[model samples]
Target: MCLYFLDCWLRTERYYELDDGDLALFESKREAFLKKYEKEIKAYRTERLIGSGTLRDYNFSSLPENILKNLDSYPPFNGYVYQNGILCARIKIEDKYFYLPPIYDEDCR
Candidate 1:
């Protein structure tokens, strides 16, 4: 289960990269991406709580707010990265780190 989440997180990081830094564009793209992968995301959330005694359905729509609320709790690190005509940023959610507009390389496996 941990591995699955890690994989998804990594994939999201890679997928989040944007060629332009327009946040409105990013939000639109993010929404579309989430909607397209809604089923998989739900399954991931469900598996995440398998043994945690909490069965409440997780809402991805609230992710941005949730991330913002917990942003200061973690150590500050350089979140933004610009490379290969794309820009990305690292974001934290709970203990996990996610890249917004994720870093990517064609050579990456």
Candidate 2:
């Protein structure tokens, strides 16, 4: 199983929020955030590497309290937050599973 954080906004909202009717135009937001968040996450990985820490070993425990609490207002949602070397979100349709962007294009396999 992926060592995932299931309830994170900066880390999960843009994708999972796509199904939330209260959020308008989430599809576009999801795409935009996917690119933006991936770059940000990659940067975090670099930061960790420079400090002698591997990306996969990093954890969210040291993040600020506010940053960790950003998802409080959104409806509760859960999924693999870190997997395949980046964040991921998935949905199922017609018995077929699909990822929001497939982080590393794992879905193409």
Candidate 3:
């Protein structure tokens, strides 16, 4: 099983507030986020790399509060953040997927 942090983009360096409607969007689509993104996010299962999967089957977690807060600073309502790596949480926007290299940050903590 995979652990995923469900998150959304923001516009002011604060946590983005999602109303019932926005929440519903996430709640309603388990396939979208878990689908795939070769552009960002690194996925691996066993010894092979996994590009996509089902969010329903994937585990969920809360993103770092600071990261969540930073997402709130973005402006575009339909864009993913992070310069060249996965942003941990947040939703996927493209129907296509991108493959990202595994993270090697010792300070991932």
Off by over 4 Å in 3: 1-14, 31-109
All candidates in order of TM-score, best leading? 1, 2, 3
Candidate 3's TM-score reads 0.17
Reference-based TM-score of each model: 0.22, 0.22, 0.17
Query: Considering every candidate listed, which one attains the maximal lDDT?
Result: 1
Model 3 score (lDDT)? 0.31
Report, for every candidate in turn, its global Cα lDDT versus the true structure: 0.37, 0.33, 0.31
Task: Give the least accurate 10-residue stretch of model 3, judged by summed lDDT.
Answer: 43-52
The true-versus-predicted C-alpha distance at residue 33 of model 3, in Å, is 6.4
Against the correct fold, how does model 1 do in TM-score? 0.22
Q: How many clashes (backbone atoms < 3 Å, residues ≥3 apart in a chain or on different chains) does model 1 have?
A: 3
Q: Against the hidden true structure, what lDDT does model 2 obtain?
A: 0.33
